[model samples]
Target: MTSPASPYVGRFAPSPSGPLHLGSVVAALASWLDARAHGGRWLVRMEDVDGPRTVPGADQVILAQLAALGMTSDDDVIYQSSRHAVYEAALARLTAMGLIYPCGCTRREIADSAPIHAVSGERPYPGTCRTGLQPGRGPRAWRVRMPAGVHCFEDRWLGRQCQDVAREVGDIVLRRADGQWAYQLAVVIDDADQGVTDIVRGADLLSSTARQQVLGQTLGLPLPRVMHVPLIVDTDGRKLSKQNGAPAVDTQAPLVALQAAWTALGFAPLPDASTAAAFLTQATDAWRLRWHIHPCSA
Candidate 1:
């Protein structure tokens, strides 16, 4: 669907750290089903912003995994690695607006004082580098000045959600000391640029929504609708991830893999389909009914 005509534009952005584990597939499948449910477009993005975490050839491998499951990007998939200039321009605008500043505090120094986030379990910065850098200290990174008040939005799955960005997240990093771009900045810019109208992802990212909403406001971009699906956890109750050594989805039997992912999305197992494509079609129809979404003309 074209940007203006599409009723919904969803995406699944996977980091090229390793491969698509079961958790990653759950997010990918949900985004694909939601896009199909609305007769909209589904795009894929490689979030290899952090070069250190990226593995060579991992992007293609992940794409292959999705293809095996009958999922593929609608448009030419974009990689964050190729969009440095755009991110720089966004940073420039925030700087021109006096909303971003150099952060000089090191992790050890900040960890000694800042409080941890309740839900996300991340240590919220205390704005130690907010006012100005210490006398002789130099800028190690850059941070957005979290404005006062709350940013609110309704998630398709989570209902009404709100977060005090200033208090809970504090000033967030836009770029790290190692020159790696921040996920928040890159994602907001990418989604706006790609005209993504809906975002269906894992619950682990739910906490980053308000921070992104505030960033989008600063950038004068439209906020996309979102739905966060439940995460697939391991025996230890931690979310499965590439970094956690979660094995790649076994694509040898595509139907079985697809059924497992479907069930993880809170759906009952579908009757055996002849092919992965057939299974996806059934899943999309069920997804549309579950979400009460009528097929859009686009």
Candidate 2:
């Protein structure tokens, strides 16, 4: 796991809406262990761009939890709230390329207009405001003019995947009605700027990968390698999340917590270790061997 010229960089980007839960830790551990397995840099990014969703002091609390779990950022952690100007500049560039448009259709209107049987029942934003907003309608959001074609990419863990951004996702919103940056745009820009070579996280984001790849091409930024691990779901078969009332990570017994997270990532119980640090060392070795990591290939 010592790649001198790999320049591999991975990140655990958690939205600071709540504390770290079992699901969140699973994603975090996968990213951290991947970075370690490749002898790369692992970063922690606070996705606090959505002001309304962010909880006060949640970032600090989350950092402390990660530290106690034996994973820490390799460099200064970045917060999305501090990068508004940069996001604005990217929007300007898209605007200049005639790829940005103001949308006035509300979420309800889009959903109602969409075919109910669509994939995941998600309304593909019928492009109502593509040409121009309805007469007398004001701009509630800004969306990108998705190019016509299928955007495809290969996943390290899930094999090949594809999506037609224009037909399947329609024009993606760049700025929300609330005037905050959207995840699709912000995350792509951040990864390119940070020179992140690899992305490892939960499989829930697998669908978004193709759209992100399209956006990367539109922005002329290099796309990062991707690996989406299995998602942690509840008894009802729904993904665990803050909105679904997932429980906070049990940190009192750090080693147990670490092992549980690793197991959630589809690994057997790691070799017995007393401390979180020791467990992580053993886990890294296991991860490297399991993935067949090679210094030059990384």
Candidate 3:
């Protein structure tokens, strides 16, 4: 746990693959409000590590949308694309520690070797390449070895949670076959580098926290307080995402969008605020009241 005397630091990291949609706004607003409520520094990061997927000019559009909604970062935005050297250094350190190994398995090959359950839908790796690879196979990606046993952590909203990475997730990839850094590896390093003390994001990413915690422990990095808010889903009960055709937020009427996001977070209607800034001020106060009752305290 972070000492109360240590300053709180939070961030909103958005992928530049698409515009800021309603679900994106809700996530951004929640993180922003949480930072403000704690008097913390809020920062933004462009998650453009997947070079091929990043759309040109999407980062600017996302920043513009945040500014229009009266949610601005306290520092200059950091781009993950420019931080490859840092990731390389971390990978080298892990390699020296013998935690990382080269793997040559493809997705289809792994799925065929270890079929994922339809209900659980988890594709836990079967340690196909844990030992020396087959004679015909060649290395394609880098994977980190997972230790056996249960890894547990407390979530501010979800309460106590546990996962066994070795049995469930298996050895995860650090670098992909396509030469892109895996999201898990990059995010763990980024949060530690930025001194992020609090993480507030959609619940869709809750399952990933345990893996990241294991990586953080391996690297001897400080673990941040995590809060996974409910996701904004569509009529089909699927989480709204760019791939699902979720539309870009209406920046022309930013306050209306802000109000919708506020309500989605289970907050009561705003107190007749005259402007978007005023509504955010009232929302920040409300967030503070709710933060005190978070499950982490219990």
Q: List the residue pairs that clash in candidate 1.
A: none
lDDT of 2 at 277: 89
Candidate 2: regions farther than 4 A off: 1-6, 116-121, 295-298
Off by over 4 Å in 3: 117-120, 293-298
Put down candidate 2 lDDT per residue, 14-94, tens digits, no spaces: 999999999999999999999998888999999998999999999998999999998999999999999999899999999
* Model 2 local distance difference test score: 0.88
Could you tell me every candidate's TM-score relative to the true structure? 0.96, 0.95, 0.95
Ranking by lDDT: 1, 3, 2
Local lDDT at 44 for model 3: 97
- In order, candidate lDDTs are 0.89, 0.88, 0.89
Span of ten consecutive residues with least summed lDDT in model 2: 114-123
